[model samples]
Target: MPLYLLRISSEQTSFRIPSLLSIAQVFDFPIRFVSSDLFRGVLVVELQREDDVEKILERDILVLSATELFAEGASYDELHTELRNNMALFDPYIHTTFRITMESCNHRIPETRQRETINTFRYTGLQGEVSMKAPQVEFVIVEDYEWEVANTPEARYARDGNFVRVYFGRRIGIGRARSLILSHSVKTRTYYGNTSMDAQMGFLMAGQALPAPGKIMYDPFVGTGSMLYAVAHWGAYVFGSDIDGRQIRGKMKGKNTRPGVYRSAAQYGVEDRFIDCLTYDVTRGPIRRGGWVDAIVTDPPYGVRAGAKRLGRKEGKKPLREDPYLMDDGEYSHQKPDYLPPSRPYELANLTLDLILLARWLLVPKGRLVFFLPTVNEDYDEIDIPIVEGMKELKFGAGSVQDFGKWGRRLITMEKTALDDGLPPTFEDHDELELTKASGKLPGHYGFNKRYAAGFPPRKDGNRSESATPPNTTLEKREEGME
Candidate 1:
């Protein structure tokens, strides 16, 4: 087995591990973690082949770079001894045009010190041009130390006494994270809504949901198709449906200044991967046959920035008997009638339940469903997660939550574990979705929506709580609607 070192971007510290694990699962790649500290932003893993690194770089947006590790040790003397003992193994790279770059985490080394360290290996039969401009082979020497050492008087956490670990490797490849970020950037995007997801997060969702190429991914609440852009970029043909036609077709002004999701797709040269997009209320959207889509990825509205709405009629409303105008052909006719259907406030619980049920019916066995579920940190209950008979929760630990000020949205990833038997879940199995309670508490009060509106409650000292949780108090009564 060959060992490799992975350098991850420090941003999105929580999402890195799950993304790595999910990508590994997708490729069915057998990997063992050598350095497993998720927060350290570096990973050393054992893989069977070197080519698999390219496969991971293709889909993972959080990884910065990867290297084929050569030698590692807790001390410089040990590492030098290992390299000297294994001179035959180092002959291939040492004889080629190569450059060595130094990297450190939680510690900084001066250029003088770095050069001094490199001098220790320079005399060991190395016969390559030190090409600083363009090297045929690139080598990286990483020195990692704990932040505690940086603040202490005993600072130089080098390999002698205080350093945590040291790595020496041949740089193999860099991740496509920068290009992906620029590709779907909202700043350059032609059309987007207020609640449009960030490009980085959308790319992560695609990685978790559609992992492989040539899969069919569908987004039910595809407002502006921001998420679908990521899915299509991953080589999956994408389809999207939303309740608002205006969003699907960006509103036209005097000229064709603004185009919709398709225009954005065309801009990215990914129109071939985009199947189609439509405007339809997800609650009554057309049903797909069993095993229709490979994955379902979406960012459903939580009524914070965008209202959560679904199509339905008011109580006691009846269908019209006849149309107001008729053509000579005896057909109800209108040249350009702008008729819109009525919609009601969709309950957060019910909306989530519907999404799960839809996935249950449409997803192929082992197909994934990745979506964001907004939750106030205080009321977030892992047990309250929606239960579907055929689906299994995949990633639900720390990597899931992307936090804001006291409010955060959790990314829920589920896989269809079994075939749908054309049956509905029993009452006791899904009573959580129902808004009824003897206390007459509205559905919104118990979940993310209510917590968002109330914000973080004030402490006993009358200061707002900065922690993820609010003060331990019951929520006050409010209107029966989402935030």
Candidate 2:
């Protein structure tokens, strides 16, 4: 098995490994790892075939570049010796037009020093044109150095900041970095919301949920259709539903109308892939059939940024009499007679339970249900995540976390394994479920405000400060409208 170098992005490091593994499984390509330095962002793996490089690249959104490793060493002396001994590998490219690209972790080398280093390879064999332009072959030199040690005068004297390991490879291919620039970006889209999922995360979630093309992807809480955009881009026909009609149908303010998710699909040239988007709440169970949708990719509201609400009763609300004459649509009226349904605060515990139940009822066999579950970093329990009766847990991990505070979201992907024989599993002991209904007197309820305030601070009118500490008010104040 030949070794290949996979260079992945530093951002969202936790997701990159599992995503690659899942993608390889979906494509039936085995990802046999030879070695990996997670901190240095390097992975050496063995692929079944050379063409599997392109297959991995097509699915992986985090991978930056891939290469066929020629030589690797722990020190400069070892690298020099290895290159000298491995002259046969470079024999074919020696006389051909080539360029050397250098990358380093925790170390920066001057161009003069790099050229001086490249000069060592020059004396190895036949002379070749050093084409800085388009080259017949491109070789890469990557160095990984200790990040904790600074490049001080004393450190430099002792070679303390020297590279820990060095890798030499010929560039074979790249990942979806370029494609994500246009197709996956929300900045390029016409519509977005406060809780709209970002392009990279959205696409990654879509990839995890819908592993194949021509699949029917559904997002019950599709705000701004961000996830739907990603799913559609991956060749899946997407349909979604949102409780708030304002999100689905942006707004019709006078003569100018701001179109929502449906029209936004045209920007990516995947308009046909977007089947429909309904203004219906997920808790109401709009999906009547079972085993229809191939995948469910959603970013549910976490009691902030977006409020979790469902149609319910309101106290002291009087029923208004409806006049048939006034309700006539063809007649010219001062305003459109839109029927507004009353909504109440939906319990977080019930909301998640509904999502799990919906996934169980709607997802086909082997179809994945990928969704995000927000939690406090300190209280993050994998067991707290809801378990559907018949769904098989595929992958679950903290996809992202706040740098300054104790807030994070886990990406839970489960596949439907069998039909529910009786009923869904109950989550009585789950800390999140208990905290949702309990008062501040409870143990876990104390950090509810702090956890919610981690990624998003309490809003002062419109502005939000970066501080993670909640305002002087109690957790009840922070939970005012979040429910």
Candidate 3:
């Protein structure tokens, strides 16, 4: 099987890789590895077989790639025509589709100084135009045989005929940029989390799970409704709940008022009536009218500052005496003043508990739950839930605490145990060391040995202890110390 590399935006790289792994797991394909550097703006996925490519390029899947490149002093139009002509020579079945687009670079090379040793030609075609600003797939052409110093060293370059370097691949799409723009657009006061979800991750998570249109899909902690929005756009009837009424109401209203908000759904030929949003506290009680959901896809609060905030003690201390939204006095501070008490302490554990409880109550028999959890706290125990029968963990994001605090998020997939099965396996008196040996750090915690091991060794410098010579010698030293 011929392999194809599926590229995604780097902004979405963390989630994207896991999403790809999840997709690979679902399709039973062996995912080699995920590479973010193969392309400048997108994460690259190398599929083991060409057949697996369709899983990602399905109608609901939003394809993203770069589209064009300019030779400093070359004729843009002539280069475009030449590239299109070259593409026409290749058999469609053998070659992947290439599109030409244009973009103006902030850097300029004057024509008078243009190098004649290498002929410069521009490439363009299905990839969108460059001037449009953000195109997913870019194209470049080289008509020179000599390779002058590569103009854009950061961009991938290849030598062709007289023009030795042609470069093109996948880039981030404008749809996401537009999403951000409209989210902050002045027409609405809707609050959209400025952070970008790994686009590749979103696509993989969505692509792997078979679309169940008309069947209800749930997101317990649907922050900004990103996951639900993606699923709904794919043809599922999405139902989402969050403790924050403002987010639920705000997103619902935004979707209803904003034109073309569901354009992806339209593009996928899905009906417009496939989404519903509401507010419910997962920890407090059963989700209203809760039952079996076809799938539960969500990016839950990852327990960092970026996670959802809880009312402070001062804010939740006093019950709402009246409607805060309607209060004539402008003393209200919280977004939903009427709902919040005077003061309360914000805790990430409490929020996690709420979401887990909600998942237990609402997930359909054998339903799938995809979530992103933070693993920064080594002391916290692995989440143990009775209903969850199996889980697949994926390590993602940069390892730094600050980076993880900002963008680090790991993915975990759980499936509800079937009724036919007896009680799920239970363990007693298990320690961290035993668990680490069993699961080898569970994907994301790659540095488990360093973090968890007791007195393993000094990591910074390879200095041996004066008394500790070797493992056997150390045992004798311990005995001598006992004497």
All candidates' lDDT scores?
0.72, 0.68, 0.41
Assess the local accuracy of residue 472 in candidate 2 as a C-alpha lDDT between 0 and 100. 16
Whole-model lDDT, candidate 3? 0.41
Q: Give candidate 2 regions above 4 Å deviation.
A: 123-127, 148-161, 178-183, 253-258, 314-337, 396-404, 419-483
Clashing pairs in 2: none
Give one clash count per candidate, in the order shown.
0, 0, 52
Which window of ten consecutive residues has the lowest lDDT sum in model 1? 465-474
lDDT of 1 by residue, 1-483 (tens): 998888888777767767877777878888777775757857888898887888777768888889888888888877777777767766787668888888877667778878888787775576888998899988888877766535543455343335677888789888966578987889998878787888999888888885457889999889888888888876788899988877778776677554578778888888889888877877666654567789999988877887677766444776444545566877555343355556666767667766777788788888888988877665455444555667767753443678885767788887888765344322122343332333232232244554566765632222221222211112222222111
User: Residue 291, candidate 1: how far off, in angstroms?
Assistant: 1.7
Candidate numbers sorted by lDDT from highest down: 1, 2, 3
Cα lDDT tens digits for candidate 2, 1-483: 778988877777767766777777667878776874553578888887878888777778888889898888997678878878887888788789888888776666667768777766665664678788898988988877665565575654465327778888899887855478566577767787788888888877877885466889898888789888878877889888887878888866785364577667887778898888887756665555677888999987767676677776554665433543344657534244365566766655456656766677778877888887765555444444446556655643333332335556667677777754234333222354343334222222123434475654432223212222221111211111101
* TM-score of every candidate relative to the true structure: 0.84, 0.80, 0.47
- Model 2, residue 264: displacement in angstroms? 1.6
Top TM-score prediction, candidate number:
1
Candidate with better lDDT, 1 vs 2: 1
